[model samples]
Target chain A: MKQSITLGSVTRFIGLAGFLETIKNVFTGKLDKEDFKNIFRKVIMPLASVLLFFAVWYLSANKLHEIEADHLINKALVEQGPAEAEKLRACIASGDKSCQPNALPSPVQVWGAYQTLLADHYVISADKKAFKKKTASLNAKRIANGEKPITYTGRPSFVDQIFTSIITVFAGFLLALFIAVPIGIVIGLSHTLRSSVNWLIQIFKPVSPVVWFLLVFMIVKTFTKNSSSDSAFIICFISVGLCSMWATLVNTAMGVSSVDKDYINVAKVLKLGPMQKVFKVILPSSLPLIFTGLRITLSVAWMVLIAIELLAQSPGLGLFVWEEFQNGANDSNSKIIAAMFVIGLIGFMLDRIMLTIQKMVSFNKND
Target chain B: MSYLELKNIYKTYGEGDNTTEVLYNINLTIEEGEFVAIVGFTGSGKTTLVNLINGLLEPTKGEVLFKGEPIVGTSHERGVIFQNYSLLPWLTVGQNVYMAVKEAFPKKSKSELNTIVSEYVAMVNLSHAINKRPKELSGGMRQRVAVARALAMKPEMIIMDEPLGALDALTRVNLQDEILNIWGKEKRTALLITNDVDEGIYMADRIIPLRPGPNATLGPEFKIDIERPRDKTEMNDNPNFKKTRNAIIEYLMEIGNERKSEVQKEYILPDLAPKSFVW
Candidate 1:
């Protein structure tokens, strides 16, 4: 019990000095027993679990290797007699064509795949820079002769694709915010309007992003048939925006309509003008629900963007994953796994950002 | 002209079969600087009466007039203190008051606006909690903020709709005195609505009873003729306070019984027309 109390005091101190505790946990420095225990529990234990996970992954990967080697040997032996099989075995031993690639890459092989992708990105970016410079000079010459400046079209790298995905989702989210908020307020204020809008909302809210993309792609196809460059970007984002806006529209309407009658009475008592009533009483009171809607819509926008990008054949992470999967090369499978983690991490970071904003704007402490 | 008048005001809620006639023929007039309290039982259309005066709800018949002009819609000239203390939960007490202050005096500098908000907040003795939100405050403190917010608007008339009804007994008395003190200072054309008879007597120069509803109307008026700075303990011993309290209580009890024995079956519809025309 005494030791528990000592550890508790040390933890309380660590909570106050968070960054200092992190540094202390990392270094082989002198400390009291309780303080050391606090640091171990607070930071080191979580890292230890991650390390344990990797160890299990490594062991499982070695088992996959054994299975692959056995399969390869069986395939060679069944296809040939003893003399031919012995020759094939010699080739397999020397790492020839008969040997099957490891089905599950070990942690280190996955690391290698990641490094290769990074190096490829670096090379492609340098090429893109040189291409831009050449295009600039060519365009400048053309402009001097009163001709139109040519646009440079270069293949996007993996990192460039990730950036494209982020920007596309943002464009979609901003558009959703713009379309849903005013519409929600209108529907919320008038009962007849809300009832009329309810039918459309219910019908469209359940439609998949893929179908939305298909519908948008059909319309955009004719308009961009003559100049198709980068029209996929517009089509992809518009589809994402349309598919993700339902949550915000529904939530905003509920928030506005359910604003306390007392606040409305207060607005009336103050005799605020229409604009002031909306800005002062209605918007401020309903902000918590609106922020919640925005957060959900943002995450939805990101989730739909990947599918939209694939449908549109746009330069984004979704295309990267699809292309790498179709390649089915030795390193390509591992690269796809890496892309999965990157997608998950970006989604997680976006959620954390929205959560922080929600916390900042919320009036209720518990929420 | 009377400072404020409800000319044969009538109000009904809902449409068709769902209609509830909450207020009927509520004719009232208050001269400038007069403090009038409309006392009633719960659900007695006191709030509806206040709404009519503030122009929140239009009268089904007749009108609510302010300074000889019929009230069309809500205006800043008539400030309102609602029963729920409708301070926006998101705004700090000072900011809540500032919203009203800024609306009333749009051209005031920010510093001037802040000064007015803080001044009224201080009047309610909530200076320490000026920067705090309404949700953080107690029931009484929240009501004080409401009172301060209404007063800060500096409107010509202030309409309070059951403002102190939700407070505890002790807090109710304290607030009543604080409100009376504030009203005594500038003497704005004030209207207080309450269910408690003593509260009305304590706060107003004249008390009017609203008879119970389904078509509630104003009953007889009773003047609270007690002198200024009246003490609760001292009022008990004073003969006039007892006389006025007894008369109002007697009237309310009589109505309470009258409302209970509604005679619904006897008068709902005529059993047979008083003529042979139906044959």
Candidate 2:
């Protein structure tokens, strides 16, 4: 059989057949009027909106910069008279580095900062590689001698901090899954248990991540006081887990409890053991809702991760952002803006990942 | 000894002033190899009775005996095909049947279980859809999968609770024939609860009516004297089929009339005339 990769097949494979069809129609000069309109709405509209956003941001940044510069010139005139004010104006007009306004960074500056962060990451990676090469024989010798090898104490780059944040979020997410699912199932199985535990969930669900961080900090600090390992990561992850787990707990309980009575009847008729019934029938039936719960739990964990990291003083994006704010360098504002975009983009990607998993597991294709 | 017996079964819901008697003094007995159907109006405690038989529910005042022993809980010996086609949506048609078969014959090997599952699926003429999930199948196909799941268990008895109610007329007739063919082969002790009088007469050895509730009970039994391998087209001409169906329908109608009269009320209408408007 001759296998052909038709345009239709390729478009379908990429999940953009409709859009691709419109593009093809336009190129061939056979576009339907409606298809042309749809192209504008679907493709061009979003791109245009993004460009509009950048234009607005650039204008706002320039305005803010001008206002700050004027404020600084006025302050100099009032505090130190015309000579100093003239000197400040001269410095500002010279486009000198010292007189720059510490205001909102322009889009171009943020882009530059993003590139700078990448370059910094590459430099740090090269340094780490070199250090590894230098210490390879020494590390091997130390391992042979049953002694601890020398470890690099270099500060993490922007990319390393992002990874740290992602890892912490995942660890917290796993912690939440392990703690909440079993408890949710147990509570969901029994009306009495559900009612008894209802108040506890309600009270804790609304508790802030900061408070959770403080509580975890107190407990983890006391427990790991004598240990050599730093307890910030432990505290950070635990706080995130506690902060984010309530959604999963509530959703899982609801899912398990609200499983179709017909399915339960089937289980009864089949005389399935309690464990078998749960795993084979009840869990499978309730999986969609449980996944919805997990999706919510993961997004919540990621959202709260930064706050927990900042409070716990863990080496993640949250710490990086705080340090940038404290440093108040000329490009620090641009770096912060870059981090904000990265955070939002990463959160969106995490949600999409969860949605894909949920779709794969769920029987209800309509969702 | 009776293969199955329900003596003085009374099922009630709530308590004190809130108590509503759903089934009252419902007594029934089925001998070995007997096929009995309890036909009734909708919401006439037909399901409650089936549940009582299947050990999903307890009779308030009486005992359910299976093989001269008091029934405790659900068992593989009596498999129930529920009205709503209670197929686990996540499971494929084959897996649904295999699940029940595995539970029924725990000692059976994997291949043996697979063979039994496929055999039942093929019996339902749904071999093509064996790997399809319940949601993917049509209503008729899902119903067939339910039948396959129940029969694959190879229970000593089969209990159906209005299993063909949701199906269209053609599918209903087709399934009625399929079920009759399967039951005829093994002569398994069966109880089918349905509202369709003709369905009861066609599929069952005996037809019994359940009176409408607040307090429901089994009424008179109509014995179906139709011959084995009954032809659906010829059933219209068969005097026995006509007699049995008419008698069951008549009994059901009489009870329905009685219940209607008990709750009937007369209201006087106001003498009013519509005013004509020229537009």
Candidate 3:
């Protein structure tokens, strides 16, 4: 059975074949049919606009190069003579050795940076394998001598940095769920507890990620004072998780409280135990809103994790961006820009994943 | 002692200027295995009265008693079937029934519980859609699931809050027969709250009218002396059925007209001028 493209809908996003086929059809003049108009509007039109943006960006980047070259030319003319100025002018005209060293890199430069990072990752992975083998033999010899075997500690690669960021955000989100959901339920069930927790929620809801990161680091540092890898990881994820937990907590409480009164009455009529009432009726009815809150919480966790990782110098994508900026090399700016797009794409994917899970559990879907 | 009783029940809401009385000095009783129906207008506080009896709401002036003990809270001994929005929409019809059965009979074996759930689902003639969720079924079907869920618990008494009120007329008559058939077999004490006079007369052993509120009270009880397995078509031919229905409807109409007069009357001064018509 064939799965037809449901144009102008989610299929345009999820069906890669449909997206590619539409573009191909347009080029081949086969997309003039009325059947493909929705595909054109929903899919091809967005692509056109994106291409237009790239064109504008490419042109502006070229203009920025000329502007900088002119500045340098004037400076050289004043300091030296026309001879050196002319040489710089020629390089500028040739589109080489121009633009401010720290100017924003164009898409092409960012693409190049992405390839370079990929190559760098491969090289580091090979190095890690070799290091592991060398350490294994050394550890074997040390074990034979009955001494403590040395462990190899190495820097994470670019790919490893991305994984680190993902894991940290997820860990924080899980922690937030663990802490917030039960509390939300309690607050939802009891008027007194709700009033008591309301103030705390209001006060802490808007506390900045940096502040949370600092507070978490201080607390975790005290606990894992002599620790290394595990401590930093725990600190990073916990800080982000706690900082982002307010959304899910508030939404969960609201969801629980606002579950249809009829359902609650049914629960009461059934004489369901407190636990049974919550799990059987309240939770199922509130699942849609709770999942909505969870989705928001997850996104918040992901957004805050980068900043937390950056502040704590935890080995994640945010740290990668910071380190690249500090490196101040020829391709450093481009590498940072590349990381920005990668961060954005990952955040989008995380939301989509959460949305899928939300749809699975929810009976009354909003979308 | 009566199986269920409400003594001098006066339910009020709010305080001071906001205080509004709903039910006033309502005393009622239901004997074991007796089927009773309370008929009322839309705002007659019938639901509030049902809630009081079910122990969901407390009466300001009095209390309810079940089996000689004052009702403190909701209990599995009294199962309730609401008109709508009763079953968990996420759960299948079978699962909805299973949930209640499991709660009421915690010691039942897994297989035995499954059997009880299916039996009730089949009893409601919804065996074909047992696996379907509440949202997938029509209004009548969902109500059937509610009925099945309530009956599966095997509660000593069943409280039905207009269980057939939302269904179509035909569906209502069909369900009325089904309920009667079920009640004939088990003889559980049932309290049905409905506005439909025919429905109340057809389903219950006694029909009671709740006068319209701000302080609604049970007006009069009409004992239905018709035999079991009463046919809806044959009910038109029965002289007792016609006489009883007319009496109930006539009582309801009197109360309805009384409530209408109770509303603030608009005044219009008669204009005493005859204008000359232009020829």
Best by TM-score: 2
| Stretches of model 3 off by over 4 angstroms after superposition | A1-37, A95-101, A143-155, A228-231, B264-279
TM-score of each: 0.80, 0.93, 0.91
Could you tell me which 10 consecutive residues in candidate 1 chain B have the lowest summed lDDT? B262-271
lDDT of 3 by residue, B52-157 (tens): 8888888999869899999987888888888674788898999989988998999999999999999999999999999888878899999988999989999899
Residue pairs with backbone overlap in model 3: none
lDDT of 2 by residue, A217-297 (tens): 888888998999988899999999989999889988998999999889989999999999899987888788888999999
> Interface RMSD of the predictions, in order shown?
1.5, 1.1, 2.0
Two-way DockQ contest, 2 vs 3, winner: 2
Query: DockQ scores for all the models shown?
Result: 0.54, 0.73, 0.60
Question: Per-prediction TM-score of chain B?
Answer: 0.93, 0.94, 0.94
Residue A301, model 1: lDDT of 91
Across B24-120, the per-residue lDDT of candidate 2 in tens digits comes to 9988899999999898899999999999999999888999999999998898989899989988878888888999999999999999999999999
List the lowest-lDDT window of 10 residues for candidate 2 chain A: A9-18
Off-target runs (Cα >4 Å) in candidate 1 are: A1-98, A101-109, A123-155, B1-3, B7-10, B24-27, B61-69, B105-119, B126-132, B168-171, B250-279
The DockQ for candidate 1, computed on C-alphas, is: 0.54
Better TM-score candidate (1, 2) = 2
